[model samples]
Target: MLTQYHIEMNREALGEHFSERALQIITTANINQDRLAGQFGHDEYHFDNNAIDKGNRYINEQRGYILATLIGAGVSPSVAWSAFGRLLHSAQDFYAHSNYVTLWLDENNASSSALEIDPLTKSILLSPKLHTGKVYFPMDVVYFIKPLRSFALKLLPKDSHGWMNLDSPEQGFKFDYAIRAAVKRTKHEFELLQKLLTPEMLAKFVDK
Candidate 1:
């Protein structure tokens, strides 16, 4: 999902379920999650692929340690929520940056009953295929040639990325689908955070 969807749209959607202060905390945390990727010189962290394969367990473990450290060190809930947002971002990307959306569409088209199954379970059932082609050269070398890199990526076929395909409407992308997936992922993250923290600790961040 794009940064706007992750930060603004999701925040608005979540507002229906949470308090104003709680919404603010999660939305701000979401924004910081995107920002921190560039700050740590680990932009790939934003698009980490492991989250897709291992499901919520992986996401919980990755951010869980950091969240625990922050709370253990007496950091504010706002600070810990930021770490949680980082986890949310990765989980959200599992749909946008992977073939999960395509598979879900296929399943939904085949039978409406497929909706009875959990979306995350559907994603877990399919192996993520993020890239269709391989580059023999050091791809990062192109970054040194600014315009050349931009031109190269632009010229490459859209299908080069799992999420993009010129043949499908919405370019094989669906904002609604992405948003729904993000919301589910966020809720899961919130639940996991609640389990990891005490009621008092959780209440500090969310209305509960």
Candidate 2:
């Protein structure tokens, strides 16, 4: 479940920024910005100029997903949850809706030993360092790597699964690194949301 703190902080930090950014990357394929917008019953956003390609593919793709989540979570004026983005399932609607057993199952390779955080991943560690308080932490990002990938892979048919393991070690490792990075990003995002909440942030509801 997402907290009010999570919702408000995200709405504050990201709400003000996503539209213009989407306008900047509407042409990218596999994103289907128009279809996604229509799914939410909103009009497709427009670009400032087709020539303003200033960033890398990751910026467009990653933020594109984030923008989608924000739009979905904020669909109503009194939307009770903040966005957990890909980290959560669609049925979730509150913070108390935790499934520790599921989380434990996903990250542990069906058992308990954790993934080793390779020290060689120094450059890739930059994203998760955004946790300033106990609100989120460094090792928490390490815990995210296997589970997040497992979560994403869950979307595929079993026959189409294991696609990532087929890649070169470096490519596999890049995917590995990216999932860890996403956890940290979400944690940082939640911490930012904590900064913008009212006491209603404490209310809870059953996950849908």
Candidate 3:
């Protein structure tokens, strides 16, 4: 997924699409997650191209746990929503930092109308044979070094892995894909939150 300025900007834009209080909670938590705290646990939360199901399941479990805390443990809705936003950052990254976008494009032949990936295409993307350009160990170390990072990134072929590519004209990224993925994930979050709270309570946290 995009990081630093890109992540900040995307989350800010997403927050602007929501209410003031909601935006505050989301942006605050989103930023925090990008920091050291979010990286404390399994890095799988950051990227797992081959194990999409595991990542999705982990995110869902987190959401459910947060919802339970909000309703049963008397945690503030703001706190719960903040954690939810953190989970969202990872879930959203699944598209940008994985081959899912490329696979989707290949399946649909660059058609913007089809945002949903079919089962077969998803399986193909997740296959171990497919190279998603994911970095590990010393390779990930390049992220801290600007020149080295640039050099390392240049070594990889474009469009074979993730969608974000600063060197490309379109930055090797697709706004439509990112936006659609965000909307779908947000809808799932909203639906789950709605089910866990009363109308009155939900209104306090999200715009009606």
Q: Which candidate is the best by TM-score?
A: 3
- Evaluate model 2: give its lDDT: 0.28
Q: Check candidate 3 and list the clashing pairs.
A: none
> How does residue 182 of candidate 1 score in lDDT?
59
* For model 2, the run of ten residues with the poorest summed lDDT: 43-52
Cα RMSD to native, each candidate?
A: 5.5, 16.6, 4.7
| Prediction 3 TM-score vs. true | 0.68
TM-score (all chains, Cα) for each model? 0.64, 0.26, 0.68
Comparing 1 with 3 on TM-score, the higher-scoring candidate is 3
Tens digit per residue, CA lDDT, model 1, 73-150: 566656565566666666666555555555666656644332233446644454454322222133333522556856
Candidate ordering by lDDT (highest first): 3, 1, 2
Q: Show model 1 residue runs off by greater than 4 Å.
A: 16-22, 33-44, 48-58, 66-73, 110-117, 122-154, 162-173
CA shift at 40, candidate 3, in angstroms? 6.1
Candidate 3, lDDT over the whole model? 0.56
- As a whole number from 0 to 100, the lDDT of residue 7 in candidate 3 is 47
Tens digit of lDDT per residue, candidate 3, span 4-119?
53345445445544576777677566556557665545445655434456666767776776666556545566766676677776666565556555566665767656366442
Whole-model Cα lDDT of every candidate shown, in order: 0.53, 0.28, 0.56
